[model samples]
Target: MLIKKAVLDGIASGDIDLLFRTWDAERVHAGSTQRTAIGVLAVDAVEETDPAELTEEDARRGGYASLDALRHDAETRDGTLYRITLHLAGEDPRIALRAEIPRGRELTALRDRVLHMGDWAVPTLEMIAAQPGVRAPDLAAQAGREKRPFKASVRRLKELGLTESLAVGYRLSPRGKAVLSAVRRATASA
Candidate 1:
């Protein structure tokens, strides 16, 4: 639902456009990787069902009906359909309340270990988060870097519990994002 909300936030408002502008600028400037990841995930997680085609406020109302049908379909197919209804199709706090999602690439000192972190930190966090819950190596490799830098950089994040271990790599912890949301909120409010 977070992913879905992120998509809605982008397309529904101009947040997606702002993100694209920032991402395009970032690519032109320096931190293309983070911007790229954000853009891609935003694009991919967006529902395949076209909101434009659906049209009207009916799309919003149809959300529940659509889920009911999907739920029934999943039940018949011997698949886990509640997951589709309850998880993905559901509204998310972070996405619905954009205040929870931090904008920009500002890094503040939450941990002494990460105080003077590298330029990659903010973007890395965004990248890891865009896919939330991948492994360290894969997350690093996903951002277009190598294993060593990815592993080294994720140390402070690990300490902060922003990421967790997978069989081969790492993925984001939900709590980590909640922390990020708080930090972003504090900064924005300030």
Candidate 2:
């Protein structure tokens, strides 16, 4: 479930608590947390809601001025309407992970994980490090890989605090840089 940055901000500030999405099937469940640009969001509830059942209060909680505005926005998308209750959970853990440079055992573990990512890992990190903020499609093309899989690979790297997503592309996190440096040094020595 994609939440707009504005809505995310509203959630973070405790001004918004409801989200309406039209999806063929439920994409998120109660208790699931999503990490966003603002922070982490906790889904409190997911219920199938009839469009006619939505009230003005729901709209306000969803950051819309009126029920009509909420309905209009919801109708623009196709599928079953689900009312999702959410709150800002807290900070994204990866934010801290990004800043922490890996060392000793931590560095060894990170290096092992990267190595286990097969051949694409180090090169992908190197590519992003060299060309921060370049488009993903362009990066994928340069890497000679399909866009979707390339993005998935980047996401894996991100989960390890090895990459930071940008508006246009990606960059190495500080932790990522240290790990990459260590990997390269180990490879050179080997």
Best by lDDT: 2
lDDT of the candidates, in the order given: 0.43, 0.92
Task: Note the residue pairs that clash in candidate 2.
Answer: none
Cα lDDT for residue 32, candidate 2: 97
Task: Compose the digit string of candidate 1's lDDT tens values, residues 63-131.
Answer: 423544433433344311111111122333222232232324422334222334666766676776676
Top-scoring candidate (TM-score): 2
In model 2, where do residues sit more than 4 Å from their true spots?
A: 76-78
Provide backbone clash counts, one per model.
9, 0
lDDT tens digits, residue span 50-144, model 2: 99899999999999988999999888889999999988888899989999998999999899889788899989999999999999999999999
Worst lDDT window (10 residues) for model 1? 79-88
Tell me the lDDT of model 1 at 28. 25
Candidate 1 residue pairs in clash (backbone atoms < 3 Å)? 10-16, 133-171, 133-172, 134-170, 134-171, 135-169, 135-170, 136-169, 136-170
lDDT of 2 at 101: 91
Model 1, residue 41: displacement in angstroms? 39
